[model samples]
Target: MFALMQSARLESLHLSVDPVTGLKAVIAIHNSQFGPALGGCRYLAYPDDESAINDAIRLAQDMSYKAVLAGLAAGGGQSVIMRAPHVESRAALFEAFGRCVEQLDGRYITAIDSGTSTADMDCIAQYTQHVTSTTAAGDPSPHAAMGVFAGIRSTASWRLGSDNLEGLRVAIQGLGKVGFALAEQLHAAGAELLVSDTDAGKVRLAMEQLGAHPIAPEALLSTPCDILAPCGLGGVLNWHSVAQLRCSAVAGCANNQLTNLQVGDQLERRGILYAPDYVINSGGLIFMALTHQGAQPEAINQQLLRISERLTGIYAHAQAEKRSPARVSDELAKKMLYGE
Candidate 1:
């Protein structure tokens, strides 16, 4: 399923794949009135070229909304590199991507996305100077996870009417960089934890590091918890899955978590305080925005703290208006885009 629901506001889009260079990339630029496009580079295996193109278009559209919500000056764009697990490719893929970016010439600045890391960006930098990886000085996952944790705290405080989560039972799905960092923060706050991952190494690491209970990925969502954190992929909460979840609140760092707008409202209808994914996942965007603005980590961190406030405000507004958080957040995002 595609992430974009369809909108006439969309200005332009582009998609391509370079086979001769042993590179498969789909780059889409959605809107650029604010400035040149900037989005993450995701390495993944798609079912077909159409799937890759669809993901590129959808994520680029999401980037437009995300950029506006984060109050950034750049437009939206995203690139996806299709590859099999450990499939042989090279700097050639990035170099070919660099060539694509050069053709665009600053219209799209590549950043480290899923299936990619900063080290990958190091290779990508050889091709284009407009590229950006999470130069977080420290581990990017911790920083990325910190933003999500801060958002989670704000969400729990707003929803539960309690800022102290000494005995809160939280289930984290995904022990990747973001998940591990979030688990660390939650553990520090005296929260009971249950974490799981597809990677046994990461699961073992989380078990050793945070003393979390390991479980299969499919079971993580229904594992009877106060808050369900999905820091992995999109479309985790959908028509078939939402009705089965037992969490009090849904919050995480993944983009496009809901299959559609109505599903978010369904969660709200079920008395599940759903923290809008776009709103909650703004941490990464916020970090990227600040970096794009040439700010230091301290300055960026200080600014990121306000996300708690922004999320809190959104929560309050949603409650007061009897609106879904997704709708409320989208209203806020659209306001930014429309300059209303």
Candidate 2:
């Protein structure tokens, strides 16, 4: 655990275990230089404690980058609740997890992430004031999708010589709330859509509702398209997958899409303009952080547009320096977080 913290440059790691509720949670705080650390709570089944710890650490790091780039007064942190086979009461488990967050005294603020929902955050809110994404805060998926949509326009302008997504073939993987919402915006913009999801129901709905062409999950990456949006899990673009990509660019709402930093170099070598995940998918973070801080609705929307502005700058810097945008983004985020 100490080694992991040291390697990741984490500020601290807090653990909570409730024997009765079977709540084994890890909250990794990556940095608090900007303000109180804020990130989403992920409740998913992990193969082991190590995987859970790694996920918390990696996501917390990215949250730091996301918050800094979005100019939010928050640092980076993440909480992961390892899901067991069954729990007698879901609310009870989350309430216990909320209490665990309360114990931190506001050092880490939790919201909804993968495998968690607004209802789950409502349960967490019942026990602590350090939680967001309640019913009142609203779902952040659409806001995140909107940010990605704007970033895609900027990407198209840089890579395809046009900011118009109209008639562009966009291949989207995953059909979760963010993915489907992004598809909706893309379809409305007159972009041809090729969508894939593990849930056949979501794929069918996209086909019927959005006129999206359904592709097999295994075939989405290699299928030729203008842009590939990965709205699913991270590590989806590794060495092998990058080698098989047939798109001009990659921009999505997934966190940590690259398996490692080296994959950024691979994308650069392949002439694929890779928008750094944290830079492009920061809208959800912007909404969750600002909403929790009581920012007005218009302020949040204005902040969302900064996603495109930041990406545009990053892309320009990458082109001028002959470097990957991912690397440039990391450097900028590090300078903000560490004064490096």
Q: Compared with the true structure, what per-residue lDDT tens digits does model 2 show for residues 90-114?
A: 9999999999999999999999999
Tens digits of per-residue lDDT, candidate 1, 1-340, equal 2334255255555555676666777778877878878788988888998888777777787888877776778888888988855545676677777777777878888787788888777677777777776343223456667777888888788778786777898888777667788888998998888887888898888788777888788888778988999888788889989988988999887777888889989998988888777666766766765676687889878866776777888888999998888889877877777765
Worst 10 residues of 1 by lDDT: 1-10
Pull out the clashing pairs in model 1. Answer: none
Candidates in order, TM-scores: namely 0.92, 0.99
Model 2 misplacement above 4 A: none
The superposed Cα distance between candidate 1 and the true structure at residue 74, in angstroms, equals 2.2
Off by over 4 Å in 1: 1-8, 84-88, 134-139
User: Top model by TM-score, which number?
Assistant: 2
The Cα error of candidate 2 at residue 48, in Å, is: 0.6
* For every candidate, C-alpha RMSD to the true structure in Å: 2.5, 0.7
Give the Cα lDDT of each candidate. 0.78, 0.94
- Clash tally, candidates in order: 0, 0
Q: Ten residues in a row with the worst lDDT in model 2?
A: 132-141
Residue-pair clashes, model 1: 0
